[model samples]
Target: MRNMGGEQVEEAVASAVALLRTATERDWETTPAGRLEWTCRYTAEHVAGDLIAYAGQLAGRATKAYVPFEITLDEGTGNEDVLQVIETTGALLAATLRTTPREVRAFHPYPYRSANREGFAALGVAEVFLHTHDIAAGLGLAYEAPAGLCADVLARIFPHVQPGADPWRTLLWATGRGDLPGRAPVTEWRWRNNLVVPAERLTLQGVTPAAATDLAAGGDGGFAWVEGGPFQGTRDAAGMLLKAYGAGVHRPEWGVFVLVRGEDGRAVGGMGFHGPPDEDGRVEIGYDLVEAARGNGYATEGLRALSAWALEREEVTSVFATTDPDNTASQAVIVRAGFARVAGEDSGSAEGAEGAEQFAYELRG
Candidate 1:
């Protein structure tokens, strides 16, 4: 539900691979996107290739920002190559940790608004930690993430670290969350959406669950989160999220659901419903979209719809959300969704992750 573990990330990819495999025998070539996105086999190959490519980056002569190097997903190359890339890269980083003096600084080519010289260093540490851990998970192998080894990098980065600030923000002038550079960072986690919609335009009417579909018909240019409709999830899951919103739960108390639909009618993203609809109808909201579909007005739309749905109940008084202060995009969405800042929150260390600082927002009776 939070930071993915190696086992979870691997399970997710395995599921995706299974679906892709079944579709293959049927002669289906499209990715989950339903388009001629990378073929099923190449899709796995590319994922492996992408990892190798990242490892190659850390291994290359260019330590500073540079164009990404290429890695082949050729059939001739076995998965062993992908594993080797990871292991080899791990060895190099380990050596760097043991030998390189902390003062000799280096950087990679990637964007993270929150990433400064110090924050970037944390990101570098996170990069190696996350990717190495994830690849092993994907391959049913085990490995250790010596975050302690890069203690110098962490120390430099930790000071500049604002709670909830992801590595990308530190690395790039850009804001919002997305994938990292030179690494596949996840442990059995299905990467979710990175929506960062503006809050100014978050109007109740504009975010009805069905708005995305209607807009596609009218050809509106802005962004919005459409309903992924009803969904089912593993028991470990609270509701219809994390698995592309598969259908199952549709209780009236569930309120509504939505996805981030681009200008096209296709639902490429999703989020909404903070909890079970209360007797008074109070409920919070959330959204998850893809890497490509971020920074549009989707999160705002989802918030609007959740509010609209809750407001329908006269007994309902308000709704709220907690987010990282550095996650300005999410905060913006919260404000625009008809909630207001009312209180402070505590964002503690990794142990008290949920304790991090949060802004409280509420709607009137």
Candidate 2:
């Protein structure tokens, strides 16, 4: 997947500003922005404010809440001046994205409490694209963002939304800004940033569908991996994640997570659930580490953290795993993570011949 970062933000801001400039002489203060109660002028200001706010979030390294501040234009600012503010703020956000570390996360309250640099960049682009569309609609002007840019934003932040034939329209519909064939109009929506869980020596970074697609296609999934890392199992898991996303049943938190080392920010392994908890409140997990990263207990620490995170949820009563009988290293990792080996029917041995040959383990809440 393409990295939707500073360049994309700059591109989006430029496109929006160029188009809005055409209508600067029009009555923006009185014209309502499409589907929004705010007027075109106010909406333009909002776009600028969001851009700067995202920049602030990343630059300040805020973890608990928003940096309590807001931008206000000078009294009697003109439409052209508003556009200038948008440009300035967009540049600020782009610069911030370029400098923020990959592992750094800051406050953002949507489905998750924090967002990384890419997440903030995606949000910045989304704000510019959607709100620019609104302003264009109100002014009776034409506007459409680049299809690739639209797809990039969707894959990163709108992972829950099934991709449509037209990414731009899908984005519009997903945000309650437009409609689609055979699908009910969206009345409420919130973009989701991928989840991150911290362990003793690693962070389990949730893989977005975009990253999953790239990884499945032999790409790096935007992670810096240790040499000989992201083994075949990680790619296979990413393929499974893409399949679930295509089916519109992929719950991001239940999808694949790349194990990133805290000290150097390099991905060392992959670990995640097969899916959400079943009706019996049991969720199965799988994991693997690169040969170069193994024997250091990274897998054990990651498994312990991820399993505990899952078990803490009200719907999950047990976390399950199964390993090949000959894979003693993996068995040790599981054992170290507090999973107990199980036998008989409770071990899922009756499921099939395959199940009987593997060692089943469970960590109960």
Candidate 3:
């Protein structure tokens, strides 16, 4: 749950610059960057450009698109000057990350239209790490970024990739930079920023595998929780999410989401799918709120938003849930969210429930 911003950007940039400075005299303009057509010099410039651009996004708070400006070196700028540009740009990004509030999100065009501070920081780190490897390979220099740094980057941005024994290698393999045993070669890839679904009073923020791991391990999962928040059920759901991620079957959008109250940005609960939709396009969802946040109807609002989002997807036809027969509050929440009750024998809940008699509910598309 540590913050993955600020000084981390500086560290990544400094590491890359230190290594590249040693080979500044080499013919960077002619040598191609690893697996890319761009020259090593061009690749290095791209890294600096991305760092500055991400910094600009956070600083400008642009929501609809990238800011209409870019960095361009002088025509005669040397390799050493380029390295300086990277250092300067890296400092800007680090400063921006430190100043941006945790709740702020800006434009980033990957799987989502926007990314938070952590997302931009991770992306900047990744650009530095991966491109450094490319330039080193092209220059015949040994290249190995710190494993912890690589792991942090993967957890934040590469949630779709299952963790491997060596984080550095796993990152390379995930982005088609290398290969791994027992997995298909990655010919195409993209880093997915976590999705944020806004509702009237709550925002269901998609839980990344990294957050799930932290939550399962008794941490806050990087969220500021309300007093008496993130109840036992939320922790249990995070454990389930961790398992699903480890098995490489967790679809991020269909996994756990923490419900953050809009007024205070304090997390009140957890809610999301049991897994992806079944063959019948049916997906089971579960949720819970802390004692202090319960009566405010946060659960109902989150369920309504999340269920509506799922049902709108072409792969889902219905959403389902189950509660103890006596848990009338939960039943009311589901009912208010547009779910209808069904007989246990006719409900999908018949297959499971820890052997307790359960009331089933369904919200069909």
Q: What is the C-alpha lDDT of each candidate?
A: 0.38, 0.93, 0.91
TM-score of each: 0.31, 0.97, 0.97
**lDDT score, residue 47, model 3?**
92
Candidates 2 and 3, the one with greater TM-score: 3
Cα lDDT of model 1 by residue, 215-255, tens digit: 33432212322443222211112222212122323222232
lDDT of 3 by residue, 1-365 (tens): 86799789999988899899999999999999988888999999999999999999999999999999999999999999999999999999999999998888999999979999999999999999999999999999988988998988888898888888899999999989999999899999998999999899888999888888789889999999999867888889999888977888778988999999888889999998899999999999999998998899899999999999999999999998988877889989999999998775555455355677787889998
Global Cα lDDT for candidate 2: 0.93
Per-residue alpha-carbon lDDT of candidate 2 for residues 1-365, written as tens digits (9 for 90 to 100): 58988999999999999999998999999999999999999999999999999999999999999999999999999999999999999999999999999889999998779999999999999999999999999999999999999999999999988888899999999999999998899999998999999998899999999999999999999999999978999999999998988887889999999999999999999999999999999999999999999889999999999999999999999999988777888889999999998885664432323544788899998
In TM-score terms, which candidate is top? 3
Clashing pairs in 2: none
Highest-lDDT candidate: 2
- The residue ranges of model 1 lying beyond 4 angstroms of the native Cα positions read 1-256, 260-263, 277-281, 344-353
- Model 2 ranges with Cα > 4 A deviation: 346-356
